[model samples]
Target: MASSLTKDSSGIPGSEKTFFGHPRGLATLFMTEMWERFSFYGMRALLPLYLVSGGTAAAGGSQGGGLAMTAATATAIYSIYLAMVYLLAMPGGWFGDRVWGPRRTVAISASVIMLGHLTLALPGQGAFFAGLALVALGSGLLKANISTMVGHLYDGPDDPRRDGGFTVFYMGINLGAFAAPLVIGTVGQQVGWHLGFALAAVGMGLGLVQFLYGTRHLNPRSGLVPEPLTREERNRVLRRTVLVVLAAAVFYGVVVVAGLYTMNWALVPITVAGLLIPVAVLVRIKRDRELSDGEQSRMTGYIWFFAAAAVFWMIYDQGGSTLAIFAADKTDTSVFGWSFPASWFQSVNPVLIMALAPLLAWIWLYLARRAKEPSTVVKFAAGLALVGLSFFLFILPLSAAGGGKVGPLWLVGIYLLQTVGELCLSPVGLSVTTKMAPAKYASQMLGVWFLAVTAGDCVTGLLSLAGVDLNTTGVVALEAAVAALAGIGVYAYRGKVRTLMGRVH
Candidate 1:
């Protein structure tokens, strides 16, 4: 079974070449992810703005634009969509490891995502909703497995180059992220939303082509199913997967027929599931008698880091939803007597990420050389604090304006701080998850890390519902306080958790 899952190196030429002192496969994966993120973030930047846009002639309607959704409704749907995108990664990862392998899974996922964007480019509310569902599912399948493939490129877990490779991979993500909003956002907000959606489809199509061509250059094990199943096991898994999909479809049909298909209804169950799944997984892991004491200790410390990451994402992810709204409604976006699309502001964080990622990577390497690097726990705490401060910075401009538009610099400042926070935490979390995870549960732990983003998104949705109408300053201040307190609490306990992490560093 293991032999079937792994390919021999004799079949491929130039597979061992180094790119920038790392595996040549890194270049292929990098560009694949870059274009993938271009499509994903491009669509995301437009979703909120598109939702709130009025469709009626009297409401200043555009051709094939908006569903006349209220802010609460738009945000609710946005939150649910983002939550599902992350939450589904667990099942997606399992499917790859057990059934298909990363290469096939990513190929299928990219195709589906392109189809989703094309569907959105068509006219109708049905198409819009359908597109969103496809994109969410496809994204879930692609995101985790690609990262896993990156890990497989290394020779072993202790490889010093692993962290730097991830940083480079992360920069590809931001590079695409940085460009999408400026291009797609402008087209969607100014030219036409459907055109923008079509552009995203084009982006994914290009990525899929790149991925297909680059497959031969990757490691022979890059797409191999980790545990090849027996014939009977494969049949059983296929049957169960089909049944689950059918059941979900039936349930959704019933809800739609019963007039109970509101976004809030969907959000309620999804949010609860997102919060509970990780806890349930942790509880089960704790009960497993097979794990070593060291493994158990690392898992326990991981929970704390996971919680801190959740808080950071909950605050940071506001850039797409609430912050987008604020930019459209409250920020002065005029430059040289011309107003830009609100979605364009979404580009700022990624642009900053691209600029700062190398600097952060150098800083980490420098600190490591000097034996002065901060522990993972400390970095996580510091990230949370920076995110909190970013929110708090909004208070002055918001307070002074008193329901009026503020300068664009205010939002830029907020994004700058938040980007710094992201630099501190996000990549570190990915690197450390690989380091500390037990061999048997490595992929599962990575899925749980994604669930932190899912849970955070759920909280963002709920917060939007409760505080959407509150003064902007008050909302920002309240969120800031919660994050600040959480950061402080984490910092206080960082020492003990570091000890619990054993030799993970």
Candidate 2:
């Protein structure tokens, strides 16, 4: 498993320890991810704002106008789209582990992502939905496999630099994110939405090109299928996939024919499936005879981490939907007598991340040197608490505003706090997933890790359908309380989780 999962130091590009004293492959992955995130966050920043613009020229021009969707409808679509993107990572991981190797899978998936963004550049409602589906499919395939390849650049399971390496990679993601809104968001909100989408397409195209050019730097083992399926197993999987597709087609056909199809109704199954897949994955891992008792026990501890992540993302990801709305409609975006785009607020978190990730990385390394580093569980708790506190900060502003707009600093502060929380959890979660993964199901475990995000987005969608008023002080307070309590709960149980984790930490 370790052989498949990590490269020998000899495999590093020229073994010179370039790219911030890590493997040279890290630079290639970092840039590729940067552009992919540029495309993704560029489109994402505008999606909610566009959806709720209600096609009114007052919001933007007629050319730049949106689908005229109600707030609930927009929220539902946004949540479902995000949920699907993460949800697909599970099957994407399976394909990487069994069919295509991680390197090949990434290359193929990136091409698909470029095509998706191109489709989005076209006009019409049909094109919009189709393009979204393509992007989600491609992103699902690309996400986990690429991260697995990153893990492959390291020397061993317990490599001290693993967490810092991921943090650097995460910085690339934020760099792209920081630039997207200023470019794509401004164009989408001012010039035209399709033009912005076209720019996003260009970003993905650049990413694909860079990735292809840099493949030589990646670990050669990333191209090897760790556990190839037999002919019989392949045939069985093919048969099941076809059957599932057909079943889905027939079900949707029936719903459309029966006049029972609506956006909200369409989302119910996705939300339900998103919530259930993680549980099913955990259950399957627990019952797998291939795993030893120690592995299963580690998985038992992982359940707690998984739940904590789901809770964190549930609040954190709302920055796109709920918070974006708050920014546009209720928060003043003026600075130095120049009004900024609401979508530009999307850039704030990424900018903060770019500034702070290196410092946090240094702090982690520094703490580790003294054998006084906090456990992963404690970091997760701190992250959860900080994000909750960000929301808690919103209460005073919203309550004091009394239906009027508040200052921009309020949102900036919220994003700053969430940024800190993300630093604590997101990259650490990625590093830990590689460390604890079972050998046979290594990439799939990464997929399961992303299911935590899927579950969070599913609940976000469900909350929208339930008509929770996101702007209400009461709702904000409740969300803050849930996150804070979850953080405290995990901190209290840190000892038990460490025990279950066996030797991993």
Candidate 3:
């Protein structure tokens, strides 16, 4: 798998691939990632709380409250946005391959995101929804491209320092994620929504500037022009067939949007048709096998991680949903005679992620010296267990408080625990897939990686629909089931998974 890489003529990343007392360009990428993450998480932190409630009371919500959206719609909308963000990686990847290279894509996408945030800062109803669509589109381009750049920073898939590099990069992401809620959420909640969203816009603008300044450290385009199509490649039947399929998709989307279709209509038909349509087309290609052997192996790994990732996200991503609402209504947010806003509780996870990622990396390094470090499956299993335990931990305080007001510490403790679990699993998954996937299907495997996230989030959407006014027993049970299922899958794939990963060095 590593053999496919070709070094730049200068032959860097030689025996010693170090720069600025670290792996080459690590800090450059770090700052770039930091601003990018700040924009992303800042936007995300505001989304659920904003949508479910609207703006803070200081902004435009009821009595300094938020928009007051139903939990079901908020959760559904969140899931759809996240799902679309990842799914659009397909188009993002293609664009990176075709028109704008990764650097240009990153800059342009971030700029679009900046515009979206600016739009949100405006008061017009049309601008409000349009801003959201813009954010989704912009995120679609940026999310995948930034990660691809991380991969581009290295030459070979199996670079020994790859894990550490991703960990470092992961820290950049969480740093942004950490600051967003605290900074923007605080302003919106304390000041007003317009001011808060404007802060988010500024954050994204910072990212764009950082990306542009750091472009020189980046790799140039690969110049992979698509090969010309021949007679069979230009088949009229296939073109017409694709057109028909698209038209059908458009019609289906309109029905679903209009509420003429059933609730699960989007989920069921999309899942079924999406799965079948691919296999049907791929069946023809399977004969010629454009996919390499490594591609096949990488594809296999992608599915397992994707499934596992889905479950992980279903539980972790709830910080903004079930947990956020819990903080607002139920927690004793008072500290030193001052009451804090509820959405601030969401800040704990990103904070913890940034703090723990390096600690976990160091701990793993220490363990590796004695051969005590866990494998990826083991790490993933531990993550699932931590999540399960976190929920279990919450049961105590929640029940004790009678689901009423409790100390902010309780929420902080839970988010901290959740962040530890995230550090154990989330960052490494990127490097793992990058190393495992075949060269030909790299981006697609990444897309498939997103599917796991989509599935997990889809489940979250369903679970989030359950009324929290109830015991939340349903949500807890659902997460537990998901955790167990993910754990079992990890165990089943342990051997082959390890082999595909090769030695972690």
What C-alpha RMSD separates each model from the true structure?
5.1, 4.4, 6.2
Model 3 pairs in collision: 53-66, 53-67, 53-68, 54-66, 54-67, 57-64, 57-65, 306-452, 332-406
Per-residue C-alpha lDDT of model 1 across residues 58-80, encoded as one tens digit per residue: 11323346777766667767887
Which of candidates 1 and 3 reaches a greater TM-score? Answer: 1
Q: Could you tell which candidate, 1 or 3, scores higher by lDDT?
A: 1
TM values, all candidates: 0.89, 0.89, 0.78
Residue range 1-505, candidate 3, lDDT tens digits:
1221233224453544343334345555677678766766776766766765643211222233445566555666666567667667766776766557767777788888899899988875567667877887888887777777776776667765565567668777777777777888888767777678888889888777766776666655322223333567558646987999999889888998887986456544433443343344333333437766655555555556656777787777777766776666567777899866666676677766666766887999999999998888888877777776677667766676663567888878777777887777776676576666666655565665665566666666654444343126555665666686677768777888766555431
Where does candidate 2 have its weakest 10-residue lDDT segment? 1-10
Q: Which candidate ranks first by lDDT, i.e. highest?
A: 2
RMSD of 3: 6.2
CA lDDT of each prediction against the hidden true structure: 0.82, 0.85, 0.66
Q: Return the candidate ranking by TM-score, descending.
A: 2, 1, 3
